[model samples]
Target: MTSTATHLTLNRTGDKQPISGFGLWKVPKESAADTVVNVLKAGYRLLDNAADYGNEKEVGDGIVRAIKEGVVKREEIFVTSKLWNTNHAKEHVRPAFERTLKDLQCDYLDLYLIHFPISLKYVDPAVRYPPEWYYDGKGPNCTLENITIRETWEAMEELVDSGLVKNIGISNFNAALIQDLLKYARIKPAVLQIEHHPYLVQQDLIDYVQKNDIAVTGYSSFGAQSYIELGVDHAIKCPPLVQHDVITAISKKHNVTPAQVLLRWATQRNIAVIPKSNNPERLASNRDVFSFNLSADEIKSISALENGHRFNDPGFFFDIPIYA
Candidate 1:
């Protein structure tokens, strides 16, 4: 078997693999045809889009074009999509993934995720609460009465059996929720995608995932640099990774850019990373990770930058009782 996954490694999720290339959530939704093609040409074998990104069609087009030009084989690409917040109902899970596949024009997903552990009412693409926020207690939106996290987990497990998704994972889930899921989950979550960076290293959570033998994936590894346009101005300015004395010295020492150091920091720690870059040149730089290795002490210096802040906090959606 060629191993349908693009990233060349596996974790204990029974059958899960990581994809490197690019994560395309924050890119301008109406990116030009040439822009996407350029990204693929730059060597990003993964395209991370979601039903919520509202740009799966564009991503799919890029993939088709890249294949047409012989940039890479369809199997050589690792395509991942996520079920939106509104479609967390057990019955709605597969249907939602189907829509994503339809838009992305793919036969099956390398990996599919529940998007978040919290569920809410099924909101459509054209809605005010675009992110799928809702207050109903008994619906997908309300974590109170309608659909519970465990219910959503069971549905995700069903997807794997159906073959719509190669593997399943969770995003934005905390340690407590992850621990609780282990008690009832028929299939353990293969990956826990969380926001990580020098500013928010999340040591305890990473340790727990490793102990459970789950492959961990890091998102937003550059902290708020990517979020500046998404209303994270604070993350945009505070404690810039480029300004870090250690990062600067290392960049000069290795004659590499600071962003490369940032990405390598996570990979060196044995965690998966999905950094997004729409710029063709930057995309190439991002995937240039395997070219250089970071030293042990330098990795520690960068890893020590955790200040206990979380970027993609979902407190407005699901309220875990542990906070009490």
Candidate 2:
């Protein structure tokens, strides 16, 4: 599997980043090293990860193995990781970044992201690494840290200046938050990562980011397939994108899998996708998406599937309105 699409430029830094990448979320730590190696061998140039994933060590090991075997060089690949919510304090940011660097066994990351707009209570690094979300017990004992997005973004800019991360971006941020960030950001965010799929197109947000020259990366492109596994009722009720008849017909017309058709839909629109799979066949199929093209009609069909569905809302995890 391969892509004809090359790199997307950052609005602020003009850095070139690979358009398609591999998502490392929900990958079991035990199999993560091998899965990453498989992705690299399959010709994937970008590896998307985060401290919250808890598999950076295995991801690093896989990269090392691939390099040692002459499969790919260090600079040949793009690596991205995020700062977890627990490390949002002005002082805790660098320590968290250092640990990610140490775990990934890399000197510098191609891209680093603020994992979420909200911050959680900080935990001492001496006590735990990638500290749990709640500083106390679950349920009624939960609390949020007194930190601002401005403070976190400021710290992220420092990472770029320190040469620890080449570019900085934001994930799971809404339009209002991004507008506010643009007001005082010394280093503009280069990319915006969010949950996007046929069921949840987010056309307005995509337009806003692109208008600002920030690239968009869509996660959970299969829509309900991912969140349904978590027993999300809304996700469970919606038909899976891969199983939708419109997507199936398009796949049949193009002689590709439903997954490929879905990915091509995003890529054709100039949005990047980070689809994850442990199977070697699926991994290869994902990379092959760029081979086919989706017609304007086909694109419309997919877009029409949108019904304002959203999965993976932080509000579901917290009692308060985290997104608001």
Candidate 3:
């Protein structure tokens, strides 16, 4: 309950989060509960789900029908989810986080990541729930589980000591595995989630995890449009940050919408963006990206369209480079 002006204060549970949310990746578990009740009636109080996005029980039946039609208020919706890569075993991380908190009809979980510092082989959600990257799901081959990110960050610090997870993070991690997961993290990882846009601007791994207070979140902010909708020939030969010509000339000098100038160049650098859209007017213009403010030379000409490019690579579909 601390970070209000559009939120993002998390580091040991001063939880606030929603710096522009709503991304249940490739949303289409039969229209994911009416696209999570149309992005929570187009206001989106942070959703960002996973369990490898096989649609967590239709995004928890659209957050229980947008909280029985009051349209919000499951504690004002800040939910987030993850923990896949075959549940990175230390006794399969609390039964894959209680089967993603019983498929997201959550009793508690404001955030919970660890979705991929890669650790496969352990498929049995009754034989493949979201055991995605193949151990035997008929793949180009993948099965590598020696499990030790300090035994899955001490079982995600025992789901923040079993209050059923208020926070616990890491996703497609870097910065030397978050500096070797903060030298054996007991709980120090409130958020990191990457694959950020502007063609992979790792900005020194987002300035070394915001110089250690963590909280970063950026997912495919609209680069290669969700891996060119998964046909992924290097995301169909890259170059489509909403049709980049310096992001449509700074989205035509800020009238907005080169996907809101690549989500206001990563929320004008405070980072946090979720960016999904099943098009209810581009899902309220991708959560109205904090109503604009991108200067500093248009966020350095869109972070100078940095080309280190990365379209959610699992080493290009299971060759397992894990960012080499």
**For every candidate, C-alpha RMSD to the true structure in Å:** 4.5, 2.3, 18.1
Alpha-carbon RMSD, candidate 2: 2.3
Pairs that collide in candidate 3 are none
- Per-residue lDDT of model 2, residues 211-255, tens digit only: 999998889888887788888889889878898999999999999
Q: Write the per-residue lDDT of candidate 1 for residues 52-143, one digit (tens) a residue.
A: 77677777777778789988787777777888877887877777888788877888888787787656657554443234455432335343
Task: Give the TM-score (vs. native) of candidate 1.
Answer: 0.87
- Each candidate's lDDT (Cα)? 0.72, 0.87, 0.83
The reply for model 1, stretches above 4 Å from the true place, is 1-8, 11-19, 32-35, 125-131, 134-145, 316-324
Better of 1 and 3 by lDDT: 3
RMSD of 3: 18.1
Best by TM-score: 2
Count of residue pairs whose backbone atoms collide, per candidate? 7, 0, 0
Model 1: how far residue 215 lies from native, Å: 1.0
Cα distance off (Å), candidate 3, residue 160: 22
Ranking by lDDT: 2, 3, 1
